[model samples]
Target: MKKKVQILSILFLGISQVAFSQIKEEKLILDRKREPEVKKIEKKKTSVTAEKNYPPKEKKTQDSLNLKYNITDVPAASDFKTSTIQGEDISPKFNADYQNNYFQLGMGNFGKILADGNISTTLENQIEVGADLHFLSTNGLKKEYNWDSSQSSANIGAYLNAFGEKGKFNINADFGLNDYNYYGIYALTPAADIDLQQKTNRFKVNGYYDFYSNNILNDVRLKSSILTDKFDAKEAQAELLVNLSKHGVEIPMDEVTMNADLGINLETINSEFSLLNDNTSNYFNATLSPKLTFFKGKSYLMVGSGFSFLNGKNNSNLLTEEAKNNKTYWFPKAEVQIAAADEFKFYGGVDGGLKLNSYANLLEENPYLVSDQELRPTETKYKFYFGIRGDVDQSIKYDVSAGFAKMNDILFFKANSLFNNDFSLNRSPYNFANTFSAAYDNGTVSEVKGSIQYFPLANLVLDGELSFAKYNLDNNENIYNKPLVVASLGGKYSLLGKKLNLGAKAIFSTDKTTNSFSFTEAGTTPNVYLETEDKNDKIGGFADLNLSAEYKVHKNFSIFALGNNLLNTNYQTFKGYKVLGAQFLGGVKISF
Candidate 1:
């Protein structure tokens, strides 16, 4: 009897589970069917209505008037003049094919591997959705000395968009992971035994809503991200922005536009270091900007100002004391654009703002960074810039600009000290001197840059740009690892009936200098003092060239090859870091 009872209980549970699953599936289907009608894609056709008279007027035979006639002579066909008609010029159409889904995979030397794929589709009510995945990994390249330099990174993202008659909504989320080593020059090879590996994980979500109405609320945006690393370092940030605009306002000028924006940002950073213990920082800032734009026949002017308030607090043992600060700032927001001619325009502006720095951003700039950093925000006092942009013809376009700005709390990366005069290590982990520290200073910076794009043919494009900058610091002689000149040239061409494409790019940067220090013992035994001496090291200049070629094998398939660092200069971008030499990657791509 007990065995039978157990069998009956098992049967009953199985039946219940099946019924519940069916009910849940039905509910989901019903919910989908109940989507709002307003969200459905609507294409309205305009129609014109004709007015009709309620009653018809009676036909009346009125009085008839007298008539008069005149005769004209006709010309013979042989005497008439005839001329030839010119035909309109029509150019031949080129191949313009596109696909929404693709997958690519490639492998190269140095144990490199790359993979990428994207898929998208549109659903009912004009709802579009897509997902993207990417991955790249490489084993350590050949080095003079043995050091592990292997790295791998991957990311996946998804997006959803809904289009409506009144507004549009879009949301996307991404997750990424990176695993790499702090492969830099070290004084001793024994230090390599220490774990130099690091891993970072990040996730981000963004959303925006754009409205077509002429109301005050025109756009809304929200962004949030979280980042974490292997060494118990974490950072998270969230921001919200709303735009308000009123058009066709007649205030001091006809057809004026009034606009205002509100923004709020919040961030938190937590880092753990072996020597510095645990550090935590909290940041918050809010901003409001109001502006007015007046337009008059190809010329427009905008005048506005920005107000911001910041509040921050941090607790860290590395610093002498805990920090708590609150500050308010105001910045200018004004610009003017005047049309000098049909193909040329002159523009000028003065603007400035406060930008917050985060650990994630610093790491992206330089992967080898120490966690014990004094995080702060940089403030730009003001920047005045003027420039002209114009097109010489249908084939050439150019833009040139110059700007100067005074700034506070500008951050720079500097190498940490490696050892003492006796060649004794300073601290654990960072003793290798492979990691960089963040340093801040106040200074004024001026820059001039110009760029041009030329299209000599329908299927050929050429681009070039150059920039120069000068920095005058109040405390430091030079900004560490800042280049004075940067330039790039690139061109793309297509041939073989648009089936074959080729591209080439070249980049150059001037030498950058970084500060290094050496300590010497000045006193004896117990009273030993270490005097510090600063030395400037120059990172040599480098030029990198890259080339690529692709040929279509079919309507939906193509094969490609890429060559990077063709010069094989093996130049150091940083003081102690050396980049990889020449490499080649061949791959196939499929599109559907």
Candidate 2:
């Protein structure tokens, strides 16, 4: 019995051992299965911790990965509405089959005659040649004054263009002659026997070259001119300009451009009369300008400065003391432009320079200048101006501006005094029977000007301009021969399919007061004093009306007529000068 019991215990113990073994094996298998999951969880926890410490890189968006392009299509003309408010076609209209040469002739009242001719042609090798001639003359009205005037002018020009792989070159030359008479001055002394004739001849030659390069130096220009007048006054001027563009240089702004200008001017005056002496003047100027554009060229600023040197000798018997022989000036130039809106722009600038007052220049504006007058340069210290210009709508535009200028040696017109005239010693110290002498004053001039243009229809245009000025002279003397208020209104219309064109213009000016002098018989001499009552006698304000009409009879022929000073108002532009009254001119133009 003991052996049997022992065997049973052994069996039981063996069974238990087997069951324990199985359990152990299953636990080992389960642990093996869970090992990967445990490691994955631990890895996930680590990844979360790392993510808290550092941010991951962002993924690129689809829109950012793709490029975009903008396209625009021009609208057809038919798409636009047609009405009187539509914008006019301002582009020049040409007859492709028309001829280039033209001639015009006309005659008017007051024994006036007019002739004009022009011819132009293009040759081989890109050469062009042209010539023009004009002549006009008018006899005095049916008044006691014997005013007769004539003008003849001619011009010839040539241009040549040469192109190569490097760049292009342009050469041009021009020659011109002008002849006129100072006839309006006869009203001052109708009985005085005098010859009033003046002539001017001018020649100019210029060349320009553009280099095809990405470098800063891109172009160069050279110009030279010679001008001479009947009074033996001669002038020569030469100019050089170099343009630089920094297009290749990368900048935050849009563009940068620079210009360098160099100029030389020479003038000489010679007279055989003892009252006038020989003189010579020389001037040299250098300027540097640079412009910067920002906001894709919507805004710009240009800064510049110039240096001028003048060397001259004034030899005139009329002056008690000699004028300045040498002078130097530094002038500033600056301008700013901002595009506040799509169609509106704001612009302002400050600029100034020395204006060379030469004998020929003065004579052109006032032909009755006294021959013995001294010539000097006018110094403009500064001119400050600001304005806004923009299109009010599709068919209207406007510009308004205000400016102030400080000037030294501003020239004005004054009647020549009879005190210095000795008929026996000289041929009357005056320029003519009715002569004016240049008077200078230092002052500040302020002006306001505005202009507007409207195109109410496709074939009609209306425009007007108005200006007002005030002068504050350094001395107590009043501003002479200056128009304080000036205004003009004009309109043009095309009828019958543009076959007939009509235009009208009206001009008005405010009265200006100037000191008039009268000679008083004195002992052995004549004394001159300002005439107080007669100051307004001959210097009254006047308004003028003008009309012009043209009818195109054919493609190559047109008839035109012009009427000037229709009001027949006898107003004096100068102290003793009176312009023509009502006059009419009719002419025919032949194009071939």
Most accurate candidate by lDDT: 1
In candidate 2, the residue pairs with backbone N, CA or C atoms under 3 Å apart (3 or more residues apart, or in different chains) clash, namely none
Candidate 1 lDDT by residue in tens digits, 1-592? 3353354345434533443443222321112222111111111101111113211121110000000000001111011011000000111111233344777788877677778777888799977788877787767544633657678888888888776766668888999898877676543453445566778899998888866553577678888889888777878878888877655444675644333333343334443343344677778878788777665555668788888788888777656887887999999988887878635778889999988888888887777786666678889989999887765554556778899999998888988765333444333545565678888999999999887765455455556778999988898888888899987666555666667866666667888988655445455654343635355778877676666677889978888777666666666766666766666778888888
Model 1 is weakest, by summed lDDT over 10 consecutive residues, at 61-70
Point out where model 2 deviates above 4 Å. Answer: 1-99, 142-144, 147-180, 184-194, 203-231, 247-250, 253-280, 290-297, 317-327, 422-433, 523-538
Instruction: Compose the digit string of candidate 2's lDDT tens values, residues 1-592.
Output: 3353354345434533443443222321222211111111010010111112122221112111111110011111111011000111111112212333777777777666666665666577644455545555565543735534545555556555554455557777777676655555432353434456666787888888766552466678887777776666667767677866544233554354332223333333322223344444455544444443222344556666656666656545455765546667787787777768635778898988876665556655666665545556788899999988765444556678899999999887776544333333233324444566677889999999987765455444556678999988897356777788987665555556667766655666787767665433345545422222234333666666666677789978888877676666666777766666777778887878
lDDT value, residue 364 of candidate 1:
75
Task: Predict model 2's lDDT versus the native.
Answer: 0.55
Clashes (N, CA, C under 3 Å) per candidate: 0, 0
Provide the TM-score for each candidate, comma-separated. 0.78, 0.71
Candidate 1: which stretches are off by over 4 Å?
Answer: 1-98, 191-194, 248-277, 419-429, 517-534
Candidate number achieving the greatest TM-score relative to the actual structure: 1
